[model samples]
Target chain A: MEFGFSEDQTLLQQTVRDFLEKECTPDAVRSLWERETGRSPELWGKLSEIGLPALMVPEVYGGLGLDERDMVLVLEETGRFALAEPIVTTAVVAAPLLGRLIDTEHSAFAASWLERIASGDALVAVAPEGQPLIADAHVAYLLLLSHGDRLYAAEPDHVQLTAQPANDQSQRLFTVNWDSQKALCLASGNEGRSLQAELLDRGAFGCAAQLLGVTDRLIEMGALYASQRKQFGVAVGSFQAVKHRLANAKVDLEYGRSIIHRSAHSVSTNSPSRSVDVSMAKSFIGEAARFAAGESLQVHGAIGYTYEQDLHIWMKRAWSLDLAFGSGAWHRARIGDALTEGGLSAPHFGFEPRGL
Target chain B: MDLTYTAEQQAFRAEARSWLEASVPKQPLASFDTPEGFEAHREWEKKLHAGGFAMVPWPTEYGGRGADLLEWLIFEEEYYRAGAPGRVNQNGIFLLGPTIMEYGTPEQKARFLPKMASSEEVWAQGWSEPNAGSDMAAIQTTAIRDGDDYVINGQKTWASRGAYAHWLFGLFRTDPESSRHKGLTFVLVPMNTPGITVRPIEKINGKKAFAEVFFDDARVPVANRLGDEGAGWSVAMATAGFERGLMLRSPARFQSTARRLVELYRATLAQGGFVDAGLRNRVTQCWIRAEAYALNTYQTVSRLLAGGKIGAEASLNKIFWSELDIEMHTVALALLESRGELLPSAPAAGDVGDWLEGYIFALAGPIYAGTNEIQRNIIAERILGLPRK
Candidate 1:
């Protein structure tokens, strides 16, 4: 029972980190503010080239078929770099949502879209479960939106889109209004209900994982700033005030990261506690990342609050991600209900067949 | 990372579950701080020892099953799930035991471990002093060597379990002229030694859970020292690492508390009171923190099992769980509102007092085992590589 990621997962993480380090530098993240699309086509193609969008797609559908554990780390790297691409919504969420339909009536359409995603020919932006504003739908080739238990695969041309940029401008949201009668029906009834359930789970959990990564990056940034920034003829980091602030954030991030991994494992393995686990991860990490962002900015003094500073890139993303899928309050409420129903079965010692 | 238990681990869990189910008192044993309660806890430890469940993570040579960290975690989960009594020998089995295993002579192991497991002698920590609570290096308790014996003379305060413990494991100044952390010796001394005096210190809960121990030429044999003279600082830090890491506060303890807290919240909600959204959020956050801590411990345990050692970053674990414990209990107390201050024995207190008791004890968590303030400094300097000014 190993809790450490497998060698393959470790390699995947390293590869993603290295790729983002090269392709999604702070300057690259900064460039998003000026672009109308708020995304890099070249970087997008590169991510698709490395098969970031294909990781969640089934192998039978021309994709990696690797579990969320593998891609969770990738999403984390994207967060670390504050990468402005829609990997989470498009690749991680949409592709997998489609993959689960491989044995359903939408198999052919799902396969075609997945192949396009794998080949960088199309990006499918998903509006999961209840949300009306679909992120990445402004630039997406296909928009997967759900209402009730029915799912539709709509073309960009088939929908009227009004762009609603997030507080973190790296994300561009679109209020999509599509003619459901004209769109391709992916699934409905029980199949669509199941698909929607997993979609929200993966999306919410992915958001938390990404926020934790950003939290880690922010702590690193804050620590570096404190070490170099002088105050009273000493490194700011040496001051107990600055040290404790960052330390608190570091503690939060560490625990948040742990839960995110656990949540991912729960989703991947289909644990009975998966819903509670995801709720716990999202609610906790949303707060942790917010703390990291606030402390990191405070430690950076004036520079962190400025638009020109790269620190805001991750900080704003963390703030925005905290509100994604479902807010921390929403998740917490759900967990409260769950606790009322089934008082925590186990405090998840390890993932079984528990990942030791 | 998979979280499923292996068949063998599951079987061990089943075995432990059944044993604890049968052996755990239906009614809670009296507080271990009380005289009768102390003996009852001692007997409980012996029962656990006879069942080979005293120190699951320790090696067989040290009266343990040689279980790995993962199994230890599982054992802790089952132990807490079965509502087992708190380990009276926690200071021994969790902190000093691991340190001694790393630094003790084979003879020391043979002499100390079996008895510690069987509760023949319960150990208390004697690290903190009047001037050295957080700054442990400032310890002034001297143990000047006199031939094969060391004459201990100084005061150690806040020695947990000292009022009832039969033995003590602590650090002392071995060299008269050396300063700070240098020239100290880690030693184990019998509580009945001549010139030793234990004065109970009442806790916030009005319990003598700890004491102030004074020594005036208390002669202990040199063989009582665990590591070489002046190596006490590192050895004590290693012991501190154990206290901070998986040993002392297993995640299961907090998790169990979280589960109970939620149950309290559920009960509170059922009463049709104004359980505000803010209160609900805090309660959920408490449970989430517990789960995160458990997951983090498993991750750390996995790392340790795969030949990794916990270092100063253990300060992270220390701060996280300690604070989480306080928060969980605080939430539970908040759920009780006006009844929050009641003692469990009070007829009017109802079920509100256990949380109050837990909250009172948890308040001491960040203060003891090295204050969270000290822990943050370790994290800032050791983990973040920040300078100490």
Candidate 2:
């Protein structure tokens, strides 16, 4: 069984990373944080030009019909730069949810939004199920809101938004007040319930991917600082105490990476174990990112504590995303329930033997 | 990114499963630490060899099926799934065998490999001495060269499986004046060689899993050297890589333990025992970590097949699996509660499982294979490019 990414996937991820290195620099992110709306239409346009938003939209809707595996690495790139944009909300969550509605009565409505999203004419924000805060709700052209088993698509005029300040300023969150009667009903009943579950898994999987990116950046920063910072006439990295901390973080990141990538594959293929796989990825990567943040700050000593150093941006993002889709403890309990219910039987341990 | 096994791979798996189902002992074999248990395991290895499943990835001439790494992984999965006996020759097949394949002369390969595969000559490692445990470069064991022979002296402690092994492979300081890592040589010696004495060392559970060997003027042929005269350190490092990496500790072993742990938790729950939420979470975490380890290994095997080299980064696998092993057993014991301390033979210990013994063995995981501390240092210095003072 092959577990490596295709060369095309590698090139796509590298292209996005190179673009971010040039356009969404730490300075650019800091500048966005200072703006009132905390949005960058220019950066979003450039990303859309590179087909980031179009990657998940159906080809029938004037967009690329690539799956989660294609977009997961790009989501990781967005996280690496801590890009102050609605890429995950628009591209990862909304586009896929809308594209899935092509078979429903809301097909025309979903297609219009998907076409706009692919061509850089529209932005979408999705409120996570049961979470009141919707990120980038103000800048989004459409909002995907949920009430029980009903999913609705509403425009800014159909909903009132109250801004909620977040620790990660790059994430502009808002509490949306919307009436389901005024918004267009996309799906309901079993269809809506299943779609909502898929949304949660996709959201959590996307966040897990981003957390991996953030953790990798944090470890890189920590190692760089340790190797450069001097203490007692030697690089601080020479000290086992400092080196081991970063090394442990690296170990956590390395193990969490495969889990995240595998989850992407699971979500893309709609594997029966998708939900548990997403939870496992989210829970493990979230904790790994948090640990990396702490070790990074500890390694940097006093400098990493200051906002001027730019390390705090990633650390704050790590903290915010760890609790976003689901917290580590929440997902752990979900897994615990699944295992206890399923009885830890053979082949349930994952990568089940095919046709055996 | 396909995770599905191929048809051929599945067929191989089916073949392995059927054979193991038919041949595996109905009753569990004893621990290989005892004499009787050691022989029992050796017999099992011979049976496996006869079945062409002893060293799946090795060439056919080496008593294997000449299978790929993926098939080897599948074989390991089925091996553990069938509750097969543990490999008494693990030190040979997993560690020294690969090193020999990499560096052995044709004669050495001919003499050692097939026997190693058949458990005809089990191997023990002699890497650590009293003063050279973590800092192996400080090895004081000397093998002074003579005509076609090396006269060995000094002691090697913590020799795994040495209590019953037929052969021992170790690093010895070859130059009297050379210090640290320099002038060292990797040598293979027969345990029956004159002046070689092995004293069994009891573990915490009073099982003789390892030994301390005192080599006083033990003569070994120079032809028995694995590599160049003064390059033993690097050669042993290669062996250490195998020890700490995927070969020795396959993920199936831990995954099997994790599966059993989940069963234990369920059995405890069915008995009307109060299982705490905290312990349940820990158990779930253990299962997830085991799965993660398995996935990570598959990714690694894929990369290796693509011609990527495994370096100090192998330390990450060592740390992950070792820690996961301990955590899995710890949660099992916690589920067992007061009964966790009871030996398998104790009254009322019925179906308490081998967690207590498993826990004892897991304690050595962090200590052996270069110690987790040394692994961390390797990750930092060699991998992260950290300075060494």
For model 1, residues A237-352, the per-residue Cα lDDT tens digits are 99999999999998988888888888888888888777778888898889899998999999999988897778988888888999888888888888877666555433332332
Pull out the clashing pairs in model 2: none
TM-score of 2: 0.98
Highest-scoring model, DockQ:
2
Candidate 1 residue B322 Cα shift, in angstroms, is 1.9
Candidate 2 stretches with Cα past 4 Å from truth are A343-347
Against the true structure, candidate 1 has what lDDT? 0.85
Report the lDDT tens digits of candidate 2 across residue range B1-389. 88889889989989999999999999988889999999999999999999999999999998888898889889999999899988899989999998998899999999999999999999999989999999999999999999999999999999999999999999999998999989999999999999999999999989999999999999999999998999999999889888887799998899999889888888889898879888788888888999999999899889988988678888999999999999999899889989999998899998887899999999889999888999999999998888888
Instruction: Please give, as one word, the docking class of candidate 2.
Output: medium
Q: Candidate 2: lDDT over CA atoms? A: 0.90
In model 1 chain B, the worst 10-residue window by lDDT is: B350-359
All candidates: TM-score: 0.96, 0.98
